[model samples]
Target chain A: MTSRERAEGPGDGIPGRAEGTGDGTPGRGERADAGVPERGERADVGVPGRAPVIERRLHPVTPLRRAWAPLAVLAGWAVHDPNAAQEQLARLTDTMLLLGIAVLVPAAGLYGFLSWWFTHYAVTDTELRIRTGLLFRRTAHIRLERVQAVDVSRPLLARVAGVAKLRIDVVGTDDKDELAFLSEREARALRAELLARAAGFAPETAREVGEAPAHVLLRVPPRELARSLVLTGATWGSLCAALVVPTLLWLFTENVWTVLVTALPLLGTAGASSVGRFVTEFDWTVSESPDGLRIDRGLLDRAHETVPPGRVQTVRIVEPLLWRWRGWVRVELDVAGSDNSVLVPVAPRAVAEAVLARVLPGASVPAGLSPVPRRARWCVPVWWRGHRLAVTGPVFAARSGLLCRRLSLVPHAKVQSVRLTQGPWERRWGLADVHVDTGAGKTVTARLRDAGEAGRLLAEQAERSRTGRRDAPPDRWMTAR
Target chain B: METGSLDGTGAPADQPVWRRLEPGLLRVRRLLLAVWAGVFAVAAGLLPGLFAGPAWAACALLPLVCAATCWRLLERNWRSWRYAERADDLLISRGVLWREETVVPYGRMQLVEVTSGPLERRFGLATVQLHTAAAATDATIPGLDPAEAERLRDRLTELGEARSAGL
Candidate 1:
């Protein structure tokens, strides 16, 4: 499934049209030349004032880029097995590698080309429609109003080719319809236009920035990223990797425990993952835009997230064991569209609190909320100080965790369901867990000592959810105060 | 530890006591188990050709032993299935071992359905299903009188409309 969106506006008209001409340039070196709508093209829109929904194909470079993997595989097989290259073509089995490459290379290229050619997307006045499928053709229609966010991203190859990917996140669907391999310029313009339109704006009079003006909230430079890596236990991964070298030496030089062998791989894998996280999320920048928060991160593959107002369903303030020593916290939002949104990847407690106040005005952390009952102590003895929940603000908040202090907030309006569950042990302790769920399956549960509290929370959250569903404005973007 | 009331109404003084399902449900459970035992009996009849006499005999008597266990568990299950209509929400508590009490608010109810299967219809019984936004919260009150099921559906639907906040 290739996801590419040229949601960027090339000045509101035919975005992918080459600047000077609609030349069918040679398919090999595919570089999209974004264009302003020609007067004739604008007239062709026929819808007097509205921008025409042009059914545009993905940038041709998409196929070539996608085909790289298979081509690389062919090259790898030939290089790795040099004997196969030197072998005489006496039999079909002897020439197996040659036959494999001949079949796979062309097949891979064809697949990529067909995939790029078959996928076409267009945005009407109210709906964004995509028609894709080489064999099993499928067409999806997403109402503009239901669109959550449109993110623009470019990986290393796409960046080199001046192409970007556009992902349109919607409600209640796991599938994020994407338009991959649009010209970077066209993708940006499309993102601006489509996002503006999604936020209830006219195509021509698009806010461009959507109203959440560009105010940098957080930026992680190389030094800060290194610091966060240490703070986030990524350094432990580094230590694990470092230990592997000595462990390897010990295995050959001295008697080693069987436990050490298994632990080595586990530690090394964990360490590598942290290193990977640090590398990709190296240059981080979180800023406020006209309509929502903008997150731009990645090293080789720069990614951009345009989270519109109210896209977030919940906010979690997580403090790792090490971070607790220094009183630092990382803020993440549970949004419907994206998997997880890190509002503040890592910040001091005060800064995190200040940010929570700015973005989610009435949200409160566990410490700010009511404490769990004394009897409920058994449920969370280690983090009794944080095992708490409250429903005084515009949302319900829960706090728990021992090694990591996690405070989660679920606004009343977006709540989909409330369930009160009790395991045998929890029941014995006269405790119950209240799960506050959203449609996207984001559930926040609070373990309450008082069964009554859990019940009350369930009832109250249900009411809150009902009221919230009634045209509740996504979120109050702090444009002014 | 005396916890909070089911619906946050401070344990209504006149809160309706949980009502049990129709006795026919026990019969339904037994009948289903009998069907399974019948299949097992056929397997047991054929087992002597492959297994030892003792193993074959044990398999042959499996249906009788299985029927008794089903009788006891089904009774316990039927005994445990109870529901209460509170002022603000409907409460259901069930389970042979791990007891669960689910409190669904009237306002959060999106749909209520009345349905009956062949056996249930034969027993003049139906089920009232309540659907909330969360699939977990979607609940079913089984083995009700057809009339009672219809009445509950109408009442719940009415209350749902009056109390519903949103999807």
Candidate 2:
């Protein structure tokens, strides 16, 4: 009748649950094994039922976390110009801080304790409930069946303390209500348990872990990283000047020691940021597990994100002008999760094509699937050409990839709005900017060097969009109007 | 949903013989903006003395400051003026430098709102904002007489709901 017996049931292939405390009643520890439902006659019914016990655990951010703040205050006192006794008093203050670490720390601990007390969460077999607040409490219950993905994450400090946060995303749940964190071991156990339980809900039986496709790991070489650094500088040159100029002015008023203490960190951060961005921004890997793909990267702390195939809405291939020569491309996927899109920051254009083909194979391109005037094509001409040309047929045409180029075919159904805009120089040169919105969530646009062509493109796309909506059910008021 | 030559201007074919700009209405708006500009100029001239430290700076900035207020009032008057009804949608163009033309299809309109501010009421004018599902695309026609604003609201409401209902 326990979770162990349920795992042993023929319907599920997951490992048996750990034993609960020897008492008949489920203990706090048993609640740690909260989601593993016992074997039941309902196993054939395929409904995930609850485990007998649940536990409440505090977040690991305790009073001991504030040890540095008071130490900082003592450090400030030590540097102040004062008599010998006064200076000694400052030194004595450090010892006092250490002694009061018992009482003072717990006083600060009260804030964290209240925060933990105010937060409450429970994960049963069927659903997860979180309730927290000081004045106006909020309670959110998410059905486990609707969960799209669960992200378990921890910063370096939290990892040292062996605790991590859990963020579970469901299709329709609001952003704030979908996240909860448990300790590191507990989070892993909970994730495994939840994934295992979700497996029972699958219409087909569960397969072994390695049954999924092998993951493709791709890393950008150091040369490519250096190139990315140069590109990042070009893109953010103005922004860098804005931050550095102010700090340089501030350094003059400070003492030599003070300037060194502050400016060193600032300089170090800038250097690290440039290097980290180069290291992390474009290094991409795609690994497939039974659950879904795990995409991991970052400059400081690594992020491992799992995206199930069922939640994917659209796939986009992006190619910016700077990376064009290198044949580098980036791929992002729109999925139903807390973060709307998954960024594959950097990939070789060739590698990206293979990945996109695997994830979204034969998905009809939105632009090319329609007839003329129903789809739009946007084009920017080369320098050698006299003018840019944008042509819209019953097809949507777009360029894809970051470094190299590939043509993207978006269909008419995806086109939302068409716009034509021209500025002073553009008008002088008879050029216009054209943008098209697609149902795929954001604006996809192309600028044409020629105004006349831009107008035609706009008109054709607008016409296509109108025709696509013509078959929609008529409103009741049309006759009366 | 189709982009056309409507441009929020009434169809050139449907103009009424007497629908030209009313001289009385135009004079009233111009007078209001003129008075507003005078009041802003006076306030700008006086504010510098209220603060300390080389108060000449505020005095020097007053005319440039007054220019902004004058321009804003004049621009509002310009944008609030409207001139259009076409076959499919009601066209309204408003705004000063950043002129905007909005088309509200009789079928797409959810409701018509008629509102009057203190200044508008004193001028015997009211503003009407037509509501639609595409929130950003709503049409607002301002600077109409109370009588005409009400009439337009009713006409738009009747046409909108009827078109919405497919009656």
Best by lDDT: 1
User: How much does each candidate deviate from the true structure in C-alpha RMSD?
Assistant: 9.2, 13.1
* Tens digits of lDDT, candidate 2, A264-306: 6665567665765654553445676655666666544545566
Tell me the lDDT of candidate 2: 0.51
How does each model score on lDDT? 0.67, 0.51
TM-score (all chains, Cα) for each model: 0.74, 0.54
CAPRI-style grade of the A/B interface in model 2: incorrect
Chain B of candidate 2 versus the native chain B: what TM-score? 0.64
Q: Can you tell me the DockQ of model 1?
A: 0.20
Candidate 1 TM-score versus the reference = 0.74
**Poorest lDDT segment (10 consecutive residues) of candidate 1 chain A:** A12-21
Clashes of 2: 30
Residue ranges of candidate 1 with Cα displaced over 4 Å: A1-52, A72-115, A172-176, A207-212, A234-268, A366-386, A468-471, A474-481, B1-24, B37-70, B82-93, B103-167
Per-residue alpha-carbon lDDT of model 2 for B116-141, expressed as tens digits? 77766676767777654332344566
How many clashes in each candidate? 27, 30
Superposed on the true chain A, the predicted chain A of model 1 yields a TM-score of: 0.77
